[model samples]
Target: MKKTEPHSSRSQQLEGAGLGFLIGFAGLLAFQLLGELVVRLLAIPVPGPVAGLLFMSVFLLVRKRTKASEPEPLLNASSLLLAHLSLLFVPAGVGIMTHIDRIKDQWLSISVALIIASFVTLFVTAWSLKILIRFMNKPEPE
Candidate 1:
């Protein structure tokens, strides 16, 4: 009689997802630490983790562009995390609950800021895309 291995397709997928999460968490920590070091060295106003995130974004973009023909393991891994990303906001929601009094005091300003920022971001994104499409379609100068 042949012995059957305990590993199965579902188990493999679960393992992959778990590994992906660990990789992403490690990447986040490494990037944040690097960003912190750079910020301290350069005396930048932005937070280290924010800078690190931007750096990671650029790295991911470049990697994707270069590996256009290849399968994107990192991208896929990150996408898996993103699929359930709303869960990540639960902590933030809880924190907000704790700050209800402060939120109430500044609700007006916070709402106004959020509305203005949303509109501004939408307008800028649309305008930039429009410009990019036009540039891409424009005829080369003689």
Candidate 2:
């Protein structure tokens, strides 16, 4: 019987992460394509990629509920990427640096828009969750 070396273990870990990333990326692309198809078929206004993310979320939820024995390797990979996700936005931040003047010109309006949107989103989310909880807690009629 042969034993696996320590370096081999490290290589396997890297391979796992790489494979996981590929799986996640493929899943996202497939979701986006399906969403785009559905949107086009239904004449919906939402962007395909956004719908894809929603689809992916629902898939993940269903997988969690039904596939108890299968470990979620892709989800773990996605979460690992998310954990260090700020690095992914560094290029966007750098690009923003080059658009300083344009941002300055529209800073006030942009800031106001962000503030309003943030508040509205916060209020709506809170209100909806509260209503949902109240409805859930209500006793059924006898």
Candidate 3:
């Protein structure tokens, strides 16, 4: 197909966005790997990805405090990720496939456990939020 000026410009913008997304993904992956290394070396019981997330959070916090402006490309990349967040479940779906036999064998127990756990989590979260709201709405003495 022959390129029109506007379409060509749009295509160039998409390519640039893709490059930016790759850069952002690489940065995130680097932090996760770094976290995994730290967790493995230190023998921490927590998940490596959770540690990596904390590390990333701290880095973003510091970046916010120190830099006058954050990287726009990363910001866009993050938004793009969040916009299509369900795609992140592909890994979990694949993992289920990998362990399909085990899951099938214990499907009933797994379903029950998941249901109970979900209700418990929902209740706790709601209770905690209610308490937080009450705390926030309380009047303080001068």
lDDT tens digits, residue span 1-78, model 2: 797688778889989888877887676678889999988899899998788878888887888899875445566656
User: Would you give me the overall lDDT of model 2?
Assistant: 0.82
lDDT of each: 0.81, 0.82, 0.86
Residue 129 deviation, candidate 1, in Å?
Answer: 6.9
Residue 108 lDDT in candidate 2: 99
TM-score of each: 0.54, 0.57, 0.67
Which order, best to worst by TM-score? 3, 2, 1
Candidate 3 structure quality by residue, lDDT tens digits, 1-142: 9756775887899899889889888887888899999999999998998998899889889999999988766677668878989999888877776888998999999999999999999999988877887799965333
Who is ahead in TM-score, 1 or 2?
2
Local accuracy of candidate 1 as per-residue lDDT tens digits, 28-95: 67878999999999999999989998888888777778876533455565677689999999988888
Model 3 Cα shift for residue 3 (angstroms): 19
TM-score of 1: 0.54
Off by over 4 Å in 2: 1-17, 97-102, 106-142
Backbone steric clashes in candidate 1, count:
0
lDDT ranking, best first? 3, 2, 1
